[model samples]
Target chain A: MRFLLLVIGILYITPVLALSPPTGRVLLTLTGSITETNAGHTAKLDRKMLNALPRYSITTKNPWVHQAHKYSGFSAVDLLKLTGGKGDLLRITALNKYVIEIPITDFTKRGAIFAMRKDSHPMSVRELGPILVMYPFDDDPKLKNETYYWRSIWQISTIEVLTSPSKE
Target chain B: MVKWFRKWLPTSKLQHWYVYGLLSLIVTITLLASSILLYSYNGNQATKQRIYEDSLWNALQFQLQSYRFLNYLVQIDKKDLPLNGAAYTQYDLLMSRVDLLRSGEVGYLIRGLTGGRTVRLLNIITGELELISLNLSKIEEGDLSYLQDMTTRLKQLDNQVNEFTILVSKGTNLYIARQRRALGENLENVRILMMCFLASLFVLCCCIAKGFSVFKINQRNNKQLLIDIQNIHEEKAKILTLVAQEARPQIQALLGVPCDNTESSNSIKESANELLHTINMFTDLALIDIKKLSLDITTESLQKNLDDYVQIFSSKLQRKGVTLVSYIDPALPDVIGLDFKRLKEIILELLLNAIKHTPEGSISINVRPSSLTPTQQPLNLENRRIGILQIAIKDTGFGLEHAIQDTLRASPTTQDNQPLILQNNIGLGLSLCYRLVHLMRGEIHFSSEATSGTEFWVDIPYEVSQSSPENISLYSCPDPKRALIFTTDNHLANALRLQLSSFNIEANRYLEGPYYDDEDLDLVIIMDSNLISPEIESNIKQWQKNGTFVLYDHQLTKDVQNKAYAAKAQSLSFPLTQSRLNGLIMDAFKTD
Candidate 1:
């Protein structure tokens, strides 16, 4: 009976907890298996909306970039928790429609950040970001390899979360 | 084989080599194991996955987006659609991928594969897309010129992008093959190392096994050798007992009772005794072969035995006119524990050898306690030294030749390695005596000159019994007479002093010459009578005065005897025994 009430409570409170619609140009979208929404099932976020949620900064060397840079944005784990994400997998797509599925645990375990700004300025498309999922490659030597480098998807546009068996 | 190696492999000296060999083997094994581990570690480090897989994605993504944007443009021209956000977004996607080819990990990969052709192509595509994106709003319906131009370029770009994708796939496959081969080499090295480790371990175990086997064999051999030595001792004892009981009496019985012929009778007895002596000697030699002979320790009165033996030999010495001088120490304890039979054999052999060599000269046999350097005890020892007995036999007829002196110089060893002279250039009888002295843990050596004499000295250790002969008061029957000793030999002089002291005689010795004037002395005694000269004769005449008895070698010519008689001196054998000294003192005092 308590579980049912908690479910009802969450459902009723979910509409109130839902994100406000993006006010400026929509830059990123969160869809599928998430509770936080603005447009029925999708949460469209602009730089203001993402920056408004929470923020962190990382100064790190990346394989794609020529030099070390500072990126500020919401952490993937924190962003997922804010959206009430319930999933085993996060399917992220870049602006070029290049898609890759990363385990949600990868983001939480590695502390990858979805960066909206570089060097305190909003990143342009030419910078490989409107928002970039920048892994702290310099923080961990293991991230220099192909397995983790593929997970550092740039120019990230959308993330559709869904549940799946861990073995696969 | 092990015996050979035992001699070759010296102990203690080669011990460090053994340790060094083992240490070197361990070092080799350690180095080998380290090498195997290091190789595998480096191989793993070398094959660690790198980020070049992103290049394959970049190339394939670029190809797909090129055609999609071109098809989107064709649709916009055909459907008469307005210029919109989708065209710009698609253009922006194309531009970003081209930028990645120009600057990202993809750029690094493409330049290595085709010398930057794909990157240059992507730049051209980037410019084309940018131009189309700017003119998007100016496009009017039925004006498909920009669309036609872009589609043709997209077709050309798509084919080249597809080629770049194939090139990347081949390169990735080749790199994976090389890494797999390196991993295979590391595994092979580990396998070889394991095999070598097992082989060396097996070799070490075999060597240890061999060492243990050799040690056990040596232990068993040592045990067998000790048992054999014990058996030899038992067998020799049995043989000695058998000879004493069975063979000897029969040999003694071989001679009939003596007819009334003194010389012939003496010869028979001498022959039988000689045969018996030979048998005893061979038996002792057998004992010497095994170990230190077990002595039949008996408490013996050495004085009585020496007296009897001297009596038996005196008649024969008389026949040869070789005056016998024998002195037995008065200080000898009345009874002492000794191997008397062996000592008798030694004395008999030495005396017989002396008699055989001397035709007509003085032979002196002196028995006294020898004061060779004492054992590691205080010099005094509270006067408790029941001393080592020394018997000296000197014959004045014929001295030893040079060859025999060499043989004597190579003295006999007392151990199981017996004197080789038993079969060497020495008389077999003396050789027996040497073995007998050694069996008693004593030493026998000789000094001889070519013409004067040879002296055989035997030192035999014995324990004195509690009963000693009577002290000075017991010999009160003798009137004390002054006797002057004249001899150059220190040993004979000392023996003569001991013998004279036993008789309660006042005796003084001059070792170099008679350089004093003591006219009251009753007798003048001299040794080696070969040492007597006119100077000694003048001293002797003055000392004896009324009647003087002097000693000189019988081998001297009549002229020497006449000179002694002209000086009113009587000649006697030298180093006088106690009884002879007693008789001489009685005569000297009677004349005085």
Candidate 2:
């Protein structure tokens, strides 16, 4: 019976263990690009580096359902700055190879945060956690369209510095 | 498809709920989809960077292993070299194999892949591998320096790769964190959106409910308004029926009793006449009085009609012994375009009121020339003019009270205390008269006093056509001592007598007869058709040689004045003015 309890505990704790902050020396690069406010800056990020940054979470209702759920992430601005990317457009890629570009300004204007947790717990792959991009879509109805929805990439594993020309 | 949906879901049923649901769904979907995309993208990017780092590390490891093999070969002993063919062959084969492996691209990695102590270690390893594999005995000084240079190049390549890998790794971590955070936020937003949508739908439903309530209230109001209109229509119909019933009996009772036995009928007729007179007087007062006004009247038929009107009005008020005194001016203009019937109604109404109030007093109708600017003059062939007249009606009966006088003067409306229906006949009559006066663009003034009684004076403007020149160019000069006698054939003698006190002319009266009189007279007027007779024509011819004798006819013919002038005599017609008479006298005196 003791052994059986030990096995159950391990099964439950394993996922929690996996969720601990990644610890190591993180390497990163920086690039100069335009931001949403038409300001130029550099940004870059890595796994080890992101784990070292500040974290936060919030609960809110989403477009698809009436139930509210907790979301966790870092400030989108801090994450972009680590990547050394100053472009208005940030192209994020997930481990599953899904790619999407988000406006960097959407982060600064709306207090947008880049998160890695949900309900105070590290997000799992199925939960679209590990990495997710978000904006304060609750404050405005304009974010309810598919354009903004499609721009939020999840399970993010990498970010590339795509040299974008300034449109403004 | 939409029509089918409305059949069951009928927007009216769940409009509010549906709106909220739609809003919530839209918000949540957008946020969730965006978060998923960002998370997946960050994950892929991180994986790619990791793979590339691994590839670099593996490449470096492979380079190091090859260097170790080279070092082992270099450490081989030349002193214990193979003395026989078999041993030499073995050694040579080993050396060749080493050369084959170390040469080309793989050899270059081993040669250049260096960083920190790793570069020196590879150099040592490669030298040892070459010596052992190739059986070399000693190393040249020049070769030693070259080997050291290889070590330096390897060190540089290792350093570069390490720096690049570290930078890329840091970038990957940050990007992943960002994607993760964004995903969380999007999810939160989606949740919030769902709530908002639901709330909006609730509001929409409330609005629809309110709209329905409003529609019901409006319908109720419309129904009430329709009922009110029906009630008003019914009330008007009932009033009309009552009026007809009352009027029929009163009229029959008034006339039926008169047509009975002879003696009673006569007595009844007298009373009836009195009643009729009172009724007639009321009718007259109710009508407008434009016809009673005058202009230079050449139409005698209109005078006869007015006389008939006066007689009718007088007979109705005999009970009060109310005498009607009329003084119609002969020079008044003929009333044209006037409603004679309405005029009679107004007069009759006034007469009735006078008779009713006055026990024994005269109601005088006086007409005289108005002092106001006369717009019409009587037709006068002699004076080239016409006359204008004004009329005033006064009652020597119960005088108008101060209050009535004030009202009449202030508003041009006269009210008498006479009752007719639910209202007063006098009030209606006065209001009608006031309105008529305005319609004719005339003025009506009221003058009254307790002692002298009340008077209503109407002023009407008129125009007349005369049988004279529109513009006169008479050569006749003025003379105070002489006059021109003009006559019409109808009772010329009597007509002359009516003018006895009117002109400053000597009587030159002569019927149709021989002229055996004064040959030195200043003027002579002939009205006899005998003026057209040969004997009279000759006499007038002889008379014109010594004096002036004017010939006129009953119907003053056009251009007759010119004919008289051609005959050297001044001819005048009836209705001649004093001024024209003076002018004719002056002309006659000029030749006297």
Candidate 3:
């Protein structure tokens, strides 16, 4: 039993992940320059699959929201880890076809998150959900700017990591 | 402005307004620095907002979402496919775009871009989009017609959104252009302000640097000037020494070996002697002024020196057709320790000064005690006498100008290089005399009565003298007798009485207020005839009857003299000498 507990502890401390294939409807796709694959060099994530990972909440205000709301989501850094994504730049696409390219540092350095729920309730498609790329604006004054605002694309459908044109 | 300020400011302003200028410069620099900081702060805030560009992007995204949704609806109708999750996603994405444009900061930007028309247009579009969204599930199974109608409506909505986006793009472009122009103007202002501030700072620094150099140069020049002045002073001393050491002795030796014994030869000798003396005095003056003159104080005959000066001046007076008379106090010491050369110079110069201006009238030099009468002075009849010896040179010349008189009357303030110029002819002589007298801690006083005469009396302290005339005359009189002086209490009478007392003729004095009425008075001398009242005249006549011989001053009138003869009183000259007074007394008591 002690040996089993130590193994679990080692698994928790290390960034070793064995993400299983999704059984629910896929809500997000990760392709290009990813190590882990559920469907041939791609990661198709379902809501339950993302939910199985650790959850996070960011209480922050934005232009789209009237007041600060506790947005429950998966951390962008943890999600990238689950997909085993690698690249300097992240190319994101929203359901509305509004696209933005951001540096990976926004996830690793600025603590960006993909919100699926607001105030403990799952958001509908019309409510800018499934995934909303958000920054904890109240945490860092630097992130509360137009550049970061434009980078926070909502209803995100896809994230493509571009290592290089030749690699793709 | 500077001229106006200068006109208003006091005359004694600093040579350069560096301090105030530096203060104003500091204030200006502070103001300019703060202005730049404030400008940068505002620019930072505008950069932070970046709201206009964000608003434009949001509007474009809203319009694009509308077209994309419309396109999807059209594709569904063309393909005759059942509307499913894909169809719902497109509708939801369009709804979210509309929501984003209709609410919050992006919504306000669209409203402003469309002149507030975005609100109504968005409301109608939102109603239509919501209607389609509500019936989207049903449309997925049965009717292509309803989907086609919704597609046309969404196309119309996309057109409206495109119009709003165009307006936003135009407004954002205009705002950005205006901001760029304003930024250019602000940058230009900052540039000009920076240039002005730097130029002023440069000028102030240059002025300070130049001021420092000028101050250093002036300091060097002043030091050089001091050295030059010292050189000039040394040169003057060398020249003075050359004249004193070489020229004066040559003149003296040339005089000693006479050429002819003629009047011209004698005159030349006299002139040579005068030149030697004048040169010596100037050398002495320099020494005395610098407080370097040392006296050869010695015990010498003060009376003999005085008599010698009197005799020499008397002969000079005779030749010049002027009289010189001297009256030495009979009670002064015969020997005293004093600087004889300086004393001789003082007397000779004073006499010469008087003779030069006198023209005709006599010059009288009187020597006496500066303080109490000879009898009242502290005398043990054996030891040395200590007193202030007053030597008064009274000339009957046309008196001095009141200005010169007042100056001489005031005691010497200091024994300095520049002696008091008592008069033009008096010149260095009397001035030198003033210095000499002060060197011995002496005082000089004078009085002038316009055309009457002037008297300069020098009173020197520390007179160390051996025998007084009063002591000498005590033996000169041979007998000590009693005499009554019926005289006014005047200085002249007091002096004469004191003289008589020195002659051992116990003299009693009387003024007009009271009479020394002694019935057995052998002899009576009346100094002032005006004091001879009727009762005094009767007593005088009685004294005559009792064989009491009497005398009166020669200055009395004929009427008083006749009365004096009736009262057996004789008339005699005033200022009687010691020998003359003794002779008169012996004659008066010959029968005894």
Candidate DockQ values, in order, are: 0.33, 0.01, 0.46
Candidate 3 lDDT for residue B5: 92
lDDT of 2 by residue, A80-158 (tens): 5544344566677764455787766767775556767766776554455467776557766676555665666655665
In candidate 3, which residue ranges exceed 4 Å CA deviation? A1-19, A86-88, A162-168, B1-17, B41-45, B77-82, B221-592
Q: What's the TM-score of each model vs. the native?
A: 0.44, 0.25, 0.47
**Recovery fraction of native interface contacts for candidate 3:** 0.77
lDDT of 1 by residue, A1-168 (tens): 999999998887656446778898889899988888887688888877688767888889876666799988887677777788888788999887768888877767877788888999988776777888887887888776667767778889999988876544
Task: Indicate the TM-score of model 3.
Answer: 0.47
Question: B1-592 in candidate 1: lDDT tens per residue?
Answer: 9999787564742343454457547955895777767686865555333534566666667777777778777777456555545566677677777777666555666667656665565566566666656565545434556767766766766666676667766666666677678668867777777677767666656556655666677779879998997797679767876886687877678565655667878778767777777887777776666654577877677766776677767657767866666777666565676778888889888888888887766677887778774463221224444458789998875777677678767764645545576666578787777777877777788878757778999988776565654422224224676667665555455556656666666677765544555556655665455555767666666655665455443344364656644455555543245565567555645534
- Model 1 chain A: ten consecutive residues of lowest lDDT: A12-21
Q: What is the interface RMSD of each candidate, in Å?
A: 2.2, 26.7, 1.4
Compute the lDDT of residue A138 as modeled in candidate 2: 74
- Please provide, for model 3 over B1-592, each residue's C-alpha lDDT reduced to its tens digit, 9 standing for 90 to 100: 9999988564422335455457557866885886679698767747634777777777777777777777777677545564457778877877777777777776666676656766767777778778877668766765666876787777666666776777778888888888888778877777777777777787677657766776677789889987885576566555666788989668978788747767677677767877887887777765664456776666677756776666554435645655454556766666666778878888888888778767765566678878732343222223555576788887777777665555665644565433445333446777788778767666677776657667778777544554433222323345556666765444344455555665556666665544455646666777666777887887778777877668765556465756745445666653234445556766776554
DockQ of 2: 0.01
Model 1: lDDT of residue A137: 80
Q: Pick the candidate with the highest TM-score.
A: 3
**Would you list the rank order by TM-score, best first?**
3, 1, 2
User: How much is the lDDT of residue B368 in candidate 1?
Assistant: 75
